[model samples]
Each structure stands twice: as C-alpha cells, then as structure tokens.
Target: MAFAGMLNDEDVRAAVKACQVPGSFDYKLFFTRVGLSARADVQGQRVFNILDRDQSGFIEEEELKLFLQNFSLGA
Candidate 1:
C-alpha cells in the first residue's frame, strides 16, 4: 500500500490495532485514517487487509465468510 503523501504505515497499524479490542472497531476512524469515503468505496483487497487484523496479509476463509455474513452478503 502506497501512502503517496496520504498516510504512513504507522497510521494503518494504529487503526488496525485499535480494532484489536473486543467490539472496539471504529469504522469511522479507520476509514478516515485510510482516506476512504466509505466502506462501499473500499476495494476488496483493502477490505480484506483491514479485516485481517493481525497484519498477516492473508484473510482466512472463515474470516471472509463472517465478514460477508456481517454485510448480509450471505456468502
């Protein structure tokens, strides 16, 4: 991910870390930090990265499945 004067790795890591707490995920803050207008505008890879949480850069099937369910995609 290239910030290109938008953000730094620390910013992303901070946002990711903030969601580590139970039910502490703040979409507004994350989106704001990432320079996304909304979740709908976020690319699939970015979404996966955000949800990855552990910065593993790999979203497991269960993780993606649960995310889809949360969005009512019913995957």
Candidate 2:
C-alpha cells in the first residue's frame, strides 16, 4: 500500500491540476503551514484563509515560496 503521505500528495497534485485551488502552493507546502498531515479538504480550508494573508484566497506565488522556506515540516 502506498504511504498515507503519498496519497495525500496525489490528492493534492490532482487538486492542483484541476485548478480547484489557486496559487502554486501545492499540497505539501500547504500541509506544513497549517500543521496538517492529510489533505482533509473541507477540514483544511479553515486555515487556508490565514495563509492567504491578504484575504485574497489566492496566495501570491512569491509569498508561498517564502512561507515554505520558513516552515520545517517533518519527514
């Protein structure tokens, strides 16, 4: 079986491709900022606005990159 994280990665990738989400933040980057391990869809959205920072729902690509660099997620 694939690791749970891997599944989350796939899901996030799919979501990214579908343009269901805005920005290039991707799944792994998002999981880290909100301190989550899974892509719990609706459950994860609550914190998304916080990361958005500008209340734009769509995070700026540059901002996402910086956010990822600052956070240290578990392996």
Which candidate has the highest lDDT of all? 1
lDDT of 1: 0.55
* lDDT tens readout by residue for model 2, 1-75: 212333344443443444434454456654553346554665456445545767787877655554443432211
CA lDDT scores, all candidates in order: 0.55, 0.48
Among the numbered candidates, top TM-score falls to 2
The true-versus-predicted C-alpha distance at residue 49 of model 1, in Å, is 12
1-75: candidate 1 lDDT, tens digit per residue: 332344445655655665666666566776676555443544535655766867787866577446434433433
RMSD of each: 10.5, 9.8
If scored against the real structure, what TM-score would every candidate get?
0.37, 0.38
Which residue pairs does candidate 2 place in steric collision? Answer: none
| Model 2 Cα shift for residue 11 (angstroms) | 16
